[model samples]
Each structure stands twice: as C-alpha cells, then as structure tokens.
Target: MPVTYIPPEQRKGILESPILQMAMQQRMQQQERQFRERELKLKEQEMPVKNLIQMGNLAKSLSDLGLDPRVILGTKA
Candidate 1:
C-alpha cells in the first residue's frame, strides 16, 4: 500500500471552496439558532413559575386587606 500526499495548495483550495465554506457557515448558523431556541424554551418554562409566585404574593396582599382573592380576581370562592 502506498500513501498519497495531497499538495498544500490543493488542500488549501479544497478547504477554501465556496460550497464547503457555505456549508460550514450554514452549520454554524444552525447551531447558534438551535442554542437560542433552547434558551427561549427554558425562559418560557420559567415564566409560569414566576407568574404563580407573583399571583400568590398578590393574593396574600389582598388577604391582608380583608379582600378575598377569588372576588378580586373574578373567580369563584
């Protein structure tokens, strides 16, 4: 078996080909987009917990004022 060596110039040419460059750029952009989407999903998941905490605080405040939360929020007791 003989080992074949690709010349440096040819290797550079292959690496710098437009198609390969475009594919690499697209892959990087896709990875970045996926990362951003994952972050957004996590933030969305966290939002409900924060909302619940805020609602609980508001309900406590209403109770301190002798007001029923359900009445204030227009819900059944």
Candidate 2:
C-alpha cells in the first residue's frame, strides 16, 4: 500500500495525540538499540574475546625476552 503525502501545512490542522507520538519514538529507539546489539554480538563472535588470555601470555613471553609487548595493550592491565 502507498501512503498519500499530506503537506505539512495541511497536516497542522490535524490534531496528533502526544502519547501516540511518544510511543512511536520509544519504539524506534528500542529497535535501534536491538539492531546495534545484534551487530556488536556478531562482530564479537567473529573474533571472540576468549583469545585474550593466550595473546596476553604471548605478550608476556615477548616482554620477558626484552621485546616491546604491543599486544599487551589489548589485555586487562
């Protein structure tokens, strides 16, 4: 179904209840948050954080050898 466009000037004469507008805005924000959370989850799953321990150990070994441990930056300080 296509929506008929109502000009803003014509739309002004129509009374919109504030509660309905608020509910629509709240629904939009909720959907936006859900979308972002799904994206974050997908990215994290692609490169799981569980590797941190292994990488941190590698960094520590490098540091022990007097090398700069740049991988340490990603680990918990």
TM-scores, one per candidate: 0.72, 0.43
RMSD vs true structure, all candidates: 3.6, 8.1
Best by lDDT: 1
| Clashing residue pairs found in predicted model 2 | none
- Badly placed stretches (over 4 Å) of model 1 are 1-9
Clashes of each: 0, 0
What is the overall TM-score of model 1 with all chains considered together?
0.72
Clash-forming residue pairs, model 1:
none
Q: Which lDDT tens digits does candidate 2 get at residues 1-77? A: 99999888878654476877788899999999999999999888867565877777888898999877874465445
Model 1 per-residue lDDT tens digits across residues 1-77: 99789998789888999999999999999999999999999999999999999999999999999999989977765
**lDDT values, one for every candidate:** 0.94, 0.80
